[model samples]
Target: MTAGVQATVNDASGDPLGAHVALVIVVVMVFWAFLVAGLMFEPYRQFGHTGRLLQLTGICHLLTVLQDSRSWSLARVGDVASILMLGLLAHLILTLPQGRIISGRRRAAVAGMYAGVVAATAVSLRYGPGFDAGCDCFPPGPELSAAAQRGLLYGSAAFFWAYGLILGGVLIWRLLIRPHPAQRRSFSLAALTGALTIVGVGGRLGLFVMPGTPAPDGPYAVVYAATLTTMVLGPLGLVTVVVRARMHQASILDATVGDQGLLPPSELENALATVLKDPTVRLTGHPPVEPGRSGVPLRIAGDHVVHLTYSSALDGQPELIRSAAALARLTLRDDHLRAELADNLEAVRASRARIVQAGDAERRRIERDLHDGAQQRLVSLAARLGLALLQLSRGQHATATATVTAAVGELQDALEELRELTRGLHSPVLENAGLAQALASLAERSPIPASVMATGERLAPAVERAAYFVAAEAVTNAIKHSQAQRITITAEIRNARLVLTIQDDGIGGARATGSGLSGLADRVAALDGRLTVTSPPGRGTALVAELPSPPHDLR
Candidate 1:
């Protein structure tokens, strides 16, 4: 009997160390598991608030686990902190993917949830039973009447149960209301994990409040297993999301860079949308400034080429977005260049058509002028000469001399009219002399009091022609329509480009789209120049034309 008792005492003494070691190992394993989750989440912190919140949730879970350690004296602190952490978890659920409390109502709801948790914790710590009847792990609560304690416990349990139900319902609603199939797919696993966690915790709390519940040994094992499973699945779910995001990023890169030919803007947008699972994705040449929209600029060689805009729901996947942008930089840049080239070619075609049409109209005008003025005068001169010949043959000397003199006068007038018409077709002064001489001659002919200022630089024929026409058209318009007393024409070479300005002090309601000005604009644009007309009502009109003038040798 004595030997048996001694053996029993030795056995009992050895078991405590083994149990303590086992507990330490369990704690170490939990700590390592949470640590791994934290490390996994660390890389995503730069992406957005979602990653940071996930890390925070993992830390809170670790702390909650520590609170159950008998060796750690953290029960009193854990009681309040753990409940608050759970409230944070609830908040995290509602703001999944983005992890932003987007609305005042949602912020208020989260605040109220924390407030309820605090109130419940106060009641549970004060009047409610502190010691679990099943596990007997906690110390006894303060002395209270049975009725008060029971009522408080039931109230706290009811509040927690409502919290769980509301969170679950919210998860379901989020799943139901998600408009995008991609969003639903991305949110499903996390939401399911969160729902399971709520169920496990609510089940344990429900069992805790029951009367005459047995120890947490037999029937309660399943609930414990479920709670533990939920804890493990929570971190796993987060890891899965991150992994999936990385995979999506890889796919985005492939879709953007794999194509041999440049994708059109529409096709590029479609490709990104399909890969990212966002139907709201689009490409724009300008920044997105709309509410609830986010933009990622695709740049090449430090120049912004285009912007990628999408719904704010995808804010959580910043790395994925950035990777796609990086890969698409060259492609988007090429596409932008191609689009610009297409626009320029179209403009060139339209300008050429307009020029051809203008040439045709000018030819028709020349034909009409010849038939009406020079040709009619020549025919009249022919008849007058025939009359003079008839007089000479009849030996009427004075009559014949008068007829001949009249014919000479008519012939001189017809030649002068033809000279004027030829000058109208192409100015001799402009073709022979430089732009300065051209402008001077133009100013001298203007109906209004006009002045000319030019640098007297010889330019390419095309440049000289454009400049001359711009000045002539401006002077004519000022005379005909502006009713101005004075007109100014200034041309100078700045940065190897001709900057011409035509200013008039007149009624300044001139529009760039007016027939004369529009034609002049097209002429200027044909030389890769810009024409700006600033004619505010009641202000003087200023028509400025900037045209490229390459070096003399280059031209």
Candidate 2:
């Protein structure tokens, strides 16, 4: 560290006449080196462009040292280099934060400045001396006529002045009007740097337009001081801009990382806006879909309206946003994914609890049905048969026969009730006849006119069972509550999963958390399948179930 300081001190005093310019160049070079090093190790490149501009801004000042030297060739080269540097500075200020040109107007401005610089260089090469009289760098060249020299030099001057004024005006306008605090700060700094650099450099270049005039020697110290001051201040302002931008981004990430999965949508939006320094950030969600969707939701960030396209980074991963606008997008996407996972976990817990509760309730219902319906009938049948035997012993044959007939009828009713209870517990038909036949039978039995469209060879037993139960429950719910005229059931194998959909043309107000649908969801969940219910009142109810095929079934 001591050695580094000593090196810096030596560099600053290397040329006493141009000491300040040398120091400014060193400071900017050091800033650039650190920026590049950080960019190499850091994952984010939010200030990559700004770093490059600072480096270029510093390198341009090297020509200042060259302008002071006695070598005519070096001085001529320095003049042309300075012209190029002016254009570069304009380009840098106009395209801040992000390095690339943003709008057509800014693009045209940069293009015009570049064209002006090129024209100026071409004319200077044609008219100016290639070398001094005693120098052996190049053969002496014929000078252009005074008229031609003035025209070329004056035209070039006009170009530089125009670029400086236009760029400075734009920055000033932004500083005055832009509502965002960060943007206003950027514009303000840029305007100050631009004003200083333009006035200082443009003034120096203006003197060269007159034909056969030598640049001032010593009395113009004020001009040299102004030029050095602007060069020094420009990089300092840039350093501040880079630091502030990085801090803003880091603060946003810190706030977000703390709340991770807990922020409600509104708070999340606010957090994002605060971090991005854009008060107008918005987020939107796309529901899970089959065959997927083509587009992502629309969100506005600062001055840019972005359509976050959906793409997956890897197989079996959730779809992620494709955005290049800001560093905040990375954190924002991560927070969203974390929140979604949290919600799904909560839903799974609730589903499990409901499943346990529903299972207990179902067991009690079965017990009650047996005790009230079949058990009572069986007891009555036993009593009547006993009476029949007693009457037969008393020789009343006709009465005994009538009692026996009544007993038999009671026995048959008891058998039917037990069979129904058994069917409810586990369908024998579904076990024996497979999915298609069972669903067909279900459609046949429904009170509402129903149709079944199932097409698959055979799925895993668990998958088939889950699919069948989903269809059965949905149909029963539609028949009982929907007051519908028609029901449609569709089952197909898609992407190695059994997909089933049940729709009813009735009053549509079914909720996934409702008792009946909730139970069906548990059944589907057990098989690692998902069930979604869409019921719009007065429109229709649609229930969809997707069950993954077991490994053997896939084979």
Candidate 3:
């Protein structure tokens, strides 16, 4: 009985220090599971599938711990469960960051891993010993024939070594090579954890398979320590990655708030790309319709104004995308307003310059008209008068009388030319009698059969002058350019504005930019008015000028 007790004690305490360490590790893992599970809850609730995978991975680790138990039934159950969960671990690793499997190839690979693990577990259950006789902690196996037992041991061992190597190789290949720069650190850590797990577990399995290997105590303990370290670090690493990602999202949102300046389209896109860590990010006026492309609509005041397109890497975090889009909408709106204000200011500057230039040209034209017309006529009249006085002094009565009569005719011609020039400058009739009578005078002077219909209401001097000039310019254009038979001018106060309309039953091709019409438009615009010309081919021409005409007291 004493000898039996000694044997039992030796079996139970093969590696006391290692057992104590493993116990501490198990306790740490338990605490870690609760802590990490709490952290993963939100991700799971929001993105259900990813959280589920993480839960399954945690379960697999728990079963892995159970596989180290001294109870035979518990060890056997844990071994089978852990083997079945290998595929889940692979699936979780491959589909990290993104919760769902995106590609068919990866899905098929995970499915194949599951099938292989099932087949391997079935073969072991059917043909292999349930427990290792050399280890007191291992579970008992089914009674099997010697040849069948050997086949199970060698085949399962070989398959598992290949499986571990393949899984480690695939994890490293998928995550380490050309991984997204933003996710590189997480991928690297996950890859390192997976590689360490495979090495530690595979090395321990290799020790058991070697010929003439003694009971696994010294080297087994070292392998076990490495395995426990990896298990502890794996979940911790994942937690770190998740926490870091959350912080990253927060930082991005904070950065957007800091960018309060008016950002141009290109600059806005660049800033968003920088914040999202996606160079493929773009801001577009319309939503993207291409395959593999996703867009977030940015709405302002319940109206969708623009779209934000980004890489699919950001698809996992819809909250982040929405927040970014809201901020982008504000930036884009401000940018548009700033651009419009700049354009308006530039247009005003250009309009003022054109007005000044037109004024200078008009002055030069008036000077030329006086020099070539009234001035010449006046000079001729003076010469004729001087000649008439000379004739009178020489006692030539008949010639002097004829010279004075010619001088009187020349003086009349000069006065008429001066009146015409002054009329062009600012019509006295418009100032004295308002727009209605001024339009009547314009129509009467027009060569075509013309009629005037106007309300006799007085208007602001500037408005009346603008309306009169619009009518005069329209009449002149119609007479000079339009082959019209009849012209109509109408002026009235409508909706607090002086509405002047001129229609001609003539050739319908008057351009608003024509020399006479352009000047008229400028005159109307100076008083905050608008001039519209409609002259479609084969249709009669019409000119409508609208000038603001408030009540006299308001003006």
Maximum-lDDT candidate: 1
CA lDDT of every candidate: 0.71, 0.64, 0.70
| lDDT tens per residue, model 3, 185-301 | 645776777677765555545444433333534665556556656655665555655666677667666666555654556667877888778888888879878776789887654
Candidate 2: C-alpha lDDT: 0.64
| Candidate 3 runs further than 4 Å off | 1-49, 63-81, 96-99, 126-144, 180-183, 198-216, 243-336, 345-506, 512-555
Arrange candidates by lDDT, highest first: which order?
Answer: 1, 3, 2
Q: If the candidates were sorted by their TM-score against the true structure, best first, what order would they fall in?
A: 2, 1, 3
Q: Which stretches of candidate 1 lie over 4 Å from their true place?
A: 1-48, 65-75, 103-105, 123-142, 176-179, 208-214, 245-258, 265-340, 346-449, 453-487, 491-499, 502-527, 531-544, 548-555
| TM-score to true structure, per model | 0.56, 0.57, 0.51
The per-residue C-alpha lDDT of model 1 at residue 319 equals 71
149 Cα displacement, candidate 3 (Å): 2.2
| Model 2 Cα lDDT, one tens digit per residue, 1-555 | 222233334434454435544544544554454344334323335433545654555566555446545787777666566666767777775664455586898799778877876676555445543212233334567766778767876775575556556666655554435424545564467557756666656554544443454333332334544554565555555555455555655565565555444344446566655654545445544522434323344443343333332222111111111222233355455555677789989988988999899989988999899899999999999999999999999999999999999999999999999987776557777778778888898899888999989874677777877888788878888988999999999998888788899999999977878888888888888778888999999999999999988557843
Q: Give the count of colliding residue pairs in each prediction.
A: 0, 0, 1
